[model samples]
Target: MIGGVTAVAANGPAVNVSSVNVTPTDPTVGETVTVEVTISNQEGSNSIVDVSSIMLRTTSEHYERVEDVGAIAPGGSLTIPITTSFDSAGEKNLLAHVSAASQSNGSRTSHLRAYYRPITIDVEAPEIDAGIAASTNNSGETTVTLTNYGNVELTDAEIRTAVDGTQRDQRSTFDITPNESESVTFDTTNYDSDAVTLTGAYTARGERHEVTRTVDLNRQVQGEIRLTSVEVTERGTAISVDGEAANIGGTDVDSVLVRIPDSETVSPASGAGEFFVGSVDASEFATFELSSSVSNGTDTLPIELTYLVDNERITTTQTIDLSTASPVSPESSQDRPAATAGGDGSAGSSGLPLIPLIVGLLVVVGGSGLLYRLWNRE
Candidate 1:
């Protein structure tokens, strides 16, 4: 209705949202899902400006924006992809809009916006119940895996706190898509308390997100190394001890280092220098230096010993059973006397033997009657 036949123009380009589709509408809370907005040259005119403005309105769901289509001329189209993550499971309404604005010659400013009917989407966020297979790992280092059967994709997944859920420290992070699975490392050094929590969420694109989860990271009280049957006999001058490191827990022991409680001198101060434990690749299994000897009498008298699986240093002390070859000489049985002594006969003995008795005994023998008579006769 510009001027009948003289037909004038309107403000901005006449555009329309060709299609509005949101994926994973039923996304799991704490997980990420995608939503696509496809616009087009509905009018097939030369009025479309840059996609200057895109609007979205929602209550319990949020999204990340990813804009790509550089410019759209007349009769051209554009597609914008955005990611949304829900905090909880519920229904949501989105008032999403995209507007095109253009500046004509002289001094004219025009604006046009395409509106998608107020769209409704169902949000289902991710829920991961993570837990530990063991309460403690003897190796000191350990691993944690997560399973997600929720409706959303877990993204920006990471640990929220350090020791006892304090501050996020040297922990790890990962993403688990819908019905996907992932895991991370739980260092036993900084945090010893089993009171811990895992945090992560579904991520898409627009803004940084925050998530927290309560997992069943219970320390396995038993996945311990129990020497059920130790054949501690003798293997030549060296001892060959063999046993199994059982997983008395529910989950698998991913990576760890097995170690034995050692008496320093038992093995000569390894002239081989500190046995480099070469990188422990597995999260729950590793092979460190084997025992070199029983007791360093001379050279390393071989002793066949296997350590109680050590997960680096994250697990509880692996209850071990060590059997060294019956040392050539049993450890000295005689108590060499205590380190403290007083005049009382029952006091500990830390000093040398009484010398007076020795001297007196010699003099008495020299003074024997027979010896004295012989000396006088001579």
Candidate 2:
């Protein structure tokens, strides 16, 4: 009886509620919905019914009313629409009614009403899910990626990284759609920690959520510089050494130099003592030459190297054998005559055959003696 319709006057026009329709058969919380109600005057009515007001109400106290709905004749019907929204998620009960009046026996009859059956609406709650990940590169750069894995979009996303007691935050604002991702980067060159911690926050469905992740940083071991293929050559009083300086470590080195320091057995050659090698990257090499004056009977040479690694100075010393060094010889001239005696006792300075010259001198002397004896006989 509480939800049933009761007419005050039975002889009045038979106006009754017929049906109710709700837009969006399934609804979510915070979404607007429209309810359409139909009213009809029964075919056997005696007079036309004047519909004054249409009212709708829900169990949650949401109400709507429309007035001045005009009139409906016998065997006719009319429909009215009302709009409202739900705040919470659940199945709600709604009631609709119509207020009408009609003329009977030359007098006006008001307050005649009819009610519709209870309406049920179901609503759903919002859902949110997200995640975060981080990684570090060899150059000390850290990148953080954020993923939105749920049905809602994430807004005002931010990320922070902490390492070696130092913390850094992203400065830009960003958003990620459902099933999408975004990334941010930070420079960790000055930090000395082997690992980094990442923290992030974002807004989804008007609620704030936070996430944390930790990742190990890429760290390179301390490397060394080595000398390979060393060769020594002695030219007059000067000794020169040639070799390749190689970086045999995992990191690059700067300001590399190779020199022959002052010593009793070996002294730096004039103007060419030390060799300057600028930079050598990892698994790379550069050729260098060092000049020095090695004393007589000295069988060993000391070579020194100095360079910078990670802004720190490093020095190393090595010794090379001088006995194995080969001496450099000058090329001979082709235009000069030999200084020694040749075969047949020929003088090397004149460059003429001795046998032929001696034969010619003996013939001239014998001819001159014969001519003189014949002239004396005459």
Candidate 3:
């Protein structure tokens, strides 16, 4: 055939990868790492097969493959972009191969030396803040807020409460992104303790992060003096007393002291105990309870109560006025005054207590976060 007039050629040509450039070089784990492969024909003029549909193998187990990229032309150029991310940090080797059946398959071959950098991500401990109660509700709650202060995303967080180290309520496994915070509640209605320690943690990306907190579930019934039944036979009358005390934080309090009010000066009716309930956790309501113990005569009496919560002493003065205990008074009577506290509700409240999830630990094995030197690329 060639002797007649012209000579024929066999294969087209081969391909060579030039420079591999990643726009935003250093990116955090779970973030998109765009891979741009610059390739061109090295030998003769042949149609290049878009072979972006490639695969990658890494030293760590925190990566995935996206899709096949298009082909590159001979002597010409083509940039195929691939988006990827990692769970752990380490080294990874990537490759791009063209199929033999494609136009530039048998003739072209390309390879890349990719170094997946090392990323340090730690799941920080859960942060907790507690205070005393503010309202008069016999039963109340405390609120505990859990914040994620890590550089990575967290999932499946769990929170639990304990009274004197006894598990009361628990919430399990929730999701949260970095810098975000969550709140959990615990009711101390039926619970009574001097102090309580709250311990919590969570699981994320197959690792566990743990954290604990200490709080004053301080409930010290020091004296025999207490407010008994005092009802409203009349219209303008109300009454209430302390409900329960629980540990809302992570630490335990041994003993709490309340001030002894002067009963002679402020009327025998005015003055009880002292207490402080900080950062209400579960049942954080303060509505007083009204009981009947009237002589059918309209009268008024004052009382004082005190307590220490979260290292703070609080004293409250309350008055129970029996104005209309007659027929009309019995028909129209007011309920108890409300109790106020820091948290929405965690413990020591009137309503039913609630639970929440707390996540904050990790596993440091062979190459998890310890080997920052061997895997990172400059």
- Per-residue CA lDDT of model 2 for 134-231, tens digit only, reads 77665667778888887566899988877755675564447987679889888877766767777778997678897777777665644467888999
Instruction: Tell me each candidate's TM-score.
Output: 0.31, 0.39, 0.32
The segments of candidate 3 whose C-alpha lies over 4 angstroms from its true place after superposition are: 1-139, 217-378
TM-score of candidate 1 against the unseen true structure: 0.31
> What is every candidate's alpha-carbon RMSD to the true fold?
21.4, 14.1, 36.2
Put down candidate 1 lDDT per residue, 1-378, tens digits, no spaces.
000121113544655565566766566565455666666654567554566655555444435434334446667777777666666677766755665554355222554444443567666544443322223354344465555554444466654444555754444457666566666665554465655555543343334444554444455442332323433333333333344434444434433333433455444224331232323222233233333344424333222222223342333443323344344343455756554445786543556455665688888987897787998999
Clashing pairs in 2: none
Model 2 residue 296 lDDT score: 85
282: Cα error in model 3, Å: 24
lDDT of 3 by residue, 138-193 (tens): 23465555667654556677776777678877766457666676667677657676
Q: Using alpha carbons, what is the TM-score of model 2? A: 0.39
* Predicted structure 2: lDDT: 0.77
Task: Output the number of the TM-score-best candidate.
Answer: 2
The superposed Cα distance between candidate 2 and the true structure at residue 182, in angstroms, equals: 2.7
Clashes of each: 49, 0, 99
The candidate, 2 or 3, that scores higher on TM-score is 2
